[model samples]
Target: MSDAMTLREITDFAENLARKAGELVRREREDNTLRTDYKHQTELVTHADVMADEFITGAIRKRFPAHRILSEETMPDLSQAEELDTPLWIIDPIDGTVNYAYGHPQVAVSIAYAEKGQVQAGVVHAPFSDETYRATKGEGATLNDKPIQHSGATEPRQSLFATGFPYTKDKLEPLINRLNAMIHQCRDLRRIGSAALDICWVACGRLDI
Candidate 1:
């Protein structure tokens, strides 16, 4: 296949898979069927996470059997991801588990396609909002199929920053110091639980920093 066709195919697959996973998670949450657990006794995990991860990885395997998968729930081992001669898929089935448990609308399903250890395409799907953000390498990003770009704010005081906290709080001194600095320098800060959605928000000009 041509390079353009390959990129388009992979990107479409990622976007579709993300949407499907997002729907699954949303439905599970709405139906009150989520079984929650803790990973490393800190990070939250749910049965929805495992189900979505399996669905995405299984679809990728069927479509591109040779591709390597590094999913947050199932195949998180990254020892082999350092050197990527083949296509790789990175997936986060439910990025904001805590928020999802709390009925927050910040949950998302994130998927990325990488080749040669470089991400070539990505998609982030927010089920609650029914919004999908997508991008391909060498092309601009989009939100809900509309092109998006970052806000052209040059001054820090005019920008709105989004950040997340680590699951473990043992070494929060540095993070606190950074937050303190940003609070003073920037207009304001938002603590969005979903890192994937935070990044998409920045790309779509919703958040400047």
Candidate 2:
């Protein structure tokens, strides 16, 4: 992959990769034999996650071998990684593993491209809904290839907010504090299981935060 590749090129690549991973996730959901295990306190990981991660990493390595990959299931040691100057591909193959394990349809696959620590392109695919959201630097975001813009609602009373808690026990207090501040102010609050989908929702105006 040449460094001269345009942002549109990278964005298209990330979108396709996310769709591929999302298809794998959807197929695994149907198998009903997901082997799930805990990574930390409440952080869930399923066989599907590993499988999708491998599929994504293998494709990226084959197409853009020089790019550094940081994936949820296979993260390189930051201490051993080179400086942030190199192009980096960040991936979340099964963004809602718990929801996926439970047959919920909120799960998604997320892929982003970053250079010098700045994200230049990203794609989030929700296979169950067949929704694909994509964005490229200097370009507006899109949902299913249609341009999307944030909701213009400015009043808290009229907005719908979204939030999620971390798996760590110690972070509860801060999360609660933040939640307390926003819950009453918004029309209602949603706690969707997937961070990547939460962001996509926000970008598409489905959620305010």
Candidate 3:
């Protein structure tokens, strides 16, 4: 098969995996089956995270045994990521663990495929809102399969911005300063807990920055 066809196949696989993982997380939350815990005494984690990660990584390994996985839950070792000579799958089973645990609707399942350090395909699925954002290299991006574009607001004062903060609070002065500056420069600011959804919103013109 041609390289382009292979890339398309990988993209489709990633999209399907993301959707399945999304459903798993949403169901877990709806059923009140989440076992919430803290990671490093700061970041939130849940049983759903591990379940989704296992489901995604296992499917990828079975379909593409040669691929390397760098998932947030099970396989987070990135020491050899730069020198790897194979396709890599990077996954975040639950992008907004805190939001997921608290019943917020901004959580997501993030999946990306990269070769030689360049991402070839990516999907961000927000089950709560039933929105799927996907993009393949050189093929543009879409939300729910419809083409999407940025808001194209050149003026900062007229643009709306979305951002997220780290779970740790040791060094938040810089982040606070940046937020202060943005609040003055931008029309408004939204602190969306999910980074994946924040970027998707920017891409889909829901947020300008």
Q: What is the C-alpha lDDT profile of model 1 across 1-209, one tens digit per residue?
A: 22445787778989999999888999998999989899899988889999999999999888777778888745745665758566778899988889998899998999998876778899999999999999998888888889998888899999999998898999999999989888999999898999998888888888998
Winner on lDDT (1 vs 2): 1
lDDT of 3: 0.88
- Model 2, 1-209: lDDT tens digits are 24678989989888888898888888877977788888865788998899999999999899888878899756765563446657888898888888999999999999988776677889999999999999998999999999998888799999998888777777698788878888888899998999998988988899876
How do the predictions measure up, each by TM-score? Answer: 0.94, 0.92, 0.94
Better of 1 and 3 by lDDT: 3
> Model 3 residue 106 lDDT?
92
How many clashes in candidate 3? 0
Clashing pairs in 3: none
lDDT of 3 at 87: 78
